[model samples]
Target: MLASHEHYRAAVAQLNSYAHAYYVLDDPIASDEEYDILYHELKAYEHAHPDHIAPDSPTQRVGGSVLESFEKHTHLQRMWSLDDVFDIAELEEWVARIHKSYPNAHFTCSPKFDGASLNLCYENGVLVSAATRGDGIIGEEVLHNAKTIASIPLTIPHKSTIEIRGEVVIPKEDFARLNAARTKQNLPLFANPRNAAAGSLRQLDSSITAERRLLFVPWGLGFVREALSQSFYESMRAIERFGFYAPKILEAQSTQEIHAYYEQIQQERENFSMMLDGMVVMVDDFALQERLGWTIKSPRFACAYKFPAVEKITKILSITNQVGRTGVITPVAELEPVEIEGATISRASLYNYTDIEKKDIRIGDCVIIIRSGDVIPKIIKPIESRRDGSQTPIAPPTHCPECGCALVQEEVILRCCNLSCKARIVESIIYFASKRALNIDGLGEKIITQLYEEGKIASIIDLYALSVEDLLELEGFKDKKAANLITAIAATKHIALWRFINALGITHIGEWASKELDRRFGLACFAKSYEEIIGIVGFGQEMAESFVEFSAVNHELISRLLALIEPLPTGSAVGSNMDSAMDSSGGDFASSAKRPLENLTFVITGTLSVPRDDMRERLENLGARVSGSVSKKTDYVLCGSDAGSKEQKARELGVKIITELDLEKLIGF
Candidate 1:
């Protein structure tokens, strides 16, 4: 035991050193294989003796507990913003003003990272707390998530408490990878690296943040108990010694030097791994900064020279209408090709007819378009001064462009009510085989389009009828490719119930709602009424109505699908006699043994050992029905940490309240 303890200590020290070397120093002392072995060893030892785990252990980065909400933390020193100067003239003017006070003052210029601002507070050389720069004075505590960043040192060399300020940024490559993954999951793409970084840093689940690979680049100090250095540049350099990636900075003696550096960064911005929107120029002398003090919202000693907005002027070639999987008509402006931020901006989403009217966009008119990484290009406005009288105004389409069906207007969107619209059908088939749905690996939009145009497939049901011979008739299908596609389609015949439901392309029924429906009803959802479905947690009237309407209208199609495929019980039916319990037509059969909580209803609230969705699935698997709200009919409220109004409502109604351990006991653990 003594030897094990000593080994654990040694492992922790070695792993931390290795991490510092790799993440901060950019010099790896150990190979990945060596690191992984030692990491697993430490993890196994800590798992066996959890009480003996050290706080600074490398394995302690991500906490097991998920937070319900972030608590507000007051900053020891206010986090101030830098004043902005857009052009060289504005920058020179600011420099001239600064020269009036300190004629020979030196300045430090660093890239202004486009990301979320973070303030990390360390106490007695040990990392303690970290937060966002909320309102400069107070912020939300995110220490648990911050610890997951390998570059952030768990312990610094400084013994006294100090606050280190930095920006949490995702590299351009990482941001692109993240968006690509999100695209596969049918999730919304983040606008840019800045938004992605901010969203990642603020996740309640630290594990999600850890997966984002956020980097913290230290720029300056905040609340220091003891002074590190008198010079601002020297102090930042000193902070680098404590295991942090130092901010990229250049010392400047004049406005020309500062402008020269700014121009260099702007010209070579594409070569950088992370996003930079501007350059921050600060007085290098600590005494000068103190004397200059601050304005109401920003430091007077520092100013930001922002890069010009990433916008380009392009002529609108034509307007095109596209029908999405949901039959919504989106207006797209095809523009004369122009480059902005190294990406070709040939087309921009005009959103709808209302947006076109508001922007007064017209064909043949020159317009300004802006784009962020991974986000679709958008039209800013028409360049009215350059608009020629020959330009024609854009008008909303009276009918569906694909099927000539009369359109229905809803709020700001126009939609074709025809379910058989060719464009809609083609898109729906693509979505049904998407990664988040049935996930037929080789099936893509181009393949589906080719198949559809060839009259080999008209509907998703027709996919089951496809043969290798029929596929071989298409342009590029060799025997192997054709066989693989047929096999891939056949493999999806026995997918989870939730995945099958999502693949149906039902309106208002996304992946989450599909899982909820699967957990509660399984196959029985086919027979459930609107009241029954709306009673479940997070199921609104629109969703319940959509499900019911889709089920009713596509009864024959669904029946045919069921005849061809078998949806295995998911979430709540992974085990037990589910195969015998329910049939294709949503019929229930008698089981040999009574399931636990066979007739009970539960309402769950707050953070738990697992996510609330997982907890609900477990309860449902034991024959309990989970509801969204606490009613008099609720048998119990499974409460975890930070349980909110639902727990109180349960108490008011005299429903039983239980913890995770209590739940385990009930499950006969």
Candidate 2:
């Protein structure tokens, strides 16, 4: 056996060599598999011989590796942030300033990733470590976990140690898969995939990193070895030549082109393999990039053009049925709306059966479909009723179409007949790939549905049976795309086991709950038997029983399914408050003069129309809270638009019905 000192030195050499290949040369020597062996060995040695572990080891680059509890890491570089400008006018002002500074300045544009930024270090291109831009400098180390991502090459070709930066993301479709998985497991929802990915990467254990199937795209340039002489676009080209997956950069010939490009990309957002928040504009010239220099946070040379939310109108042709991972039957409205957003709009979500009942949406209804631009299009409401069969109620499916099992209804959701129902197999695969669940890349709704329909796949376990050739044969699947999808599936084996647990679409479980289980017991230990897990802090009888039941019935199935996933390391401990970790911005907003509501709830009605959401978030930040519907606890109802029932409800509850102006006065805004 090698001595601890030898092991330490060996690990350093291995990591450093990896960095060299990945950064300086853009070529790689060691495969990730080879590097992983060395790293794991080094980690094992360090655990056994902590004293021998060198401080400057590549492993030291990250912050939260193996930490049972995290001590706050103060950033070496203050995490100064960028000031945001949402619209074109602000973007124009920014450009004008640059033009004013150096007349004859033009711009170049790159696609903005809608994912989280990360600082990466490579000791010779074998990715040695990764950290979030937590506070700016010091961040949780997730080397073991990051290695699982296929796009993040383990070693570079030329071989020289380097630290690089990139964004960690889940593609838009993958975000949908994750959310679907979460829905099946009854997990709390994530607003978008960007939020989901950010949360996933921040987990302490690198093992959890493996399961997230995060894809890193080199966007902003961080550390460069040789003197660079190229345009911003050329520089990015240089970066890509170095073997990184550069962000998709498109040219905008005119303002219309720029808008069109943005719109085009936004329309295809769902079709992409990675998520993007906005598009970045830059000068293609290297000298121009240098001339632009850096702002406190963002570089002055580039500007991000944010896409507006897509909105459109469609007639509700009919309500459609969709089986979820947990077998919940969802009602979707097939539309005939002229596509206003980038892509065609043929469908919109009606949410659950309760929503259907509430909206009283019927077939052939003239409903307005809203896409919010980039995200999924959803049904707003029907324009009263045109020809009404009195707003036909969609009957819930009573049995699994793919398997003979009686459907069950609870909480207003129509669920499949059996937990392992054949119909649920496609749904499960979709859930497994959703943005909130396992976050598998390239696995989309139509694709998963097709796989099941073709009788080539069933159950989440069936995903493992797929070969690249299988994918290649499918429509629109290309060589690179097929490879990427296969790689993504292979990489998922190593994801945080809790993500797997959460992806199973269990009852009474969510990301938060899965995390709770991970915190209380490691995935391996927790999965052994439900009885042992029940003893955990919050594992009540109901939750405990459910956990046990799922395990008992699905143990073999989950085991086989897990075998298909690549084994990723678990996250280390961090300074996280389990309940509050979602987004730990402290305290709600309230004006000093008004005295913050401190969790006080209020309602809104009518249309004074500052856009209700705008007012709501503003109030929330001010410490005053707002709820959608009126309730007894509502202190005030800010009235706007067509105020009818809500206004009456406010009066009946003896609650104050205030105008938008009144709300403005109260907040002193």
Model 1: which ten-residue window has the lowest total lDDT?
Answer: 583-592
List per-prediction Cα lDDT, in the order shown: 0.83, 0.64
lDDT of 2 by residue, 1-669 (tens): 346586678777777668556533447888889777777777778888888776445555443354333334333233334445467677767767876777666556666776777766655555666667775646766555566555566555534545566788876666777878889999997766677888777665655555565677776545556534455566667667765776667654345556667777768766666655577776666577676676545666666677665555567667667776676777777777475533466777788878877877777777777655255677777787455564565665666555655555556676663546765666667777886676677787867887778776866776777888887777768899889987777666556655677788777665545654654566574355666777665456666666665666566776676566633323433221321222223432221233454446678665555655556545654555466778887888877765767888888989988876786677565
Give Cα distance to truth, residue 114, candidate 1, Å: 1.2
Q: List TM-score per model, in order.
A: 0.55, 0.39
Q: Report the lDDT tens digits of candidate 1 across residue range 583-641.
A: 32232211214356665788898779886765665565566767889999889999988
Positional deviation of residue 373's Cα in model 2 after best superposition, in angstroms: 8.2
Q: For model 2, what is the error of residue 56's alpha carbon versus the real structure, in angstroms, after optimal superposition?
A: 18
TM-score computed on alpha carbons, candidate 1: 0.55
Global CA lDDT of candidate 1, please?
0.83
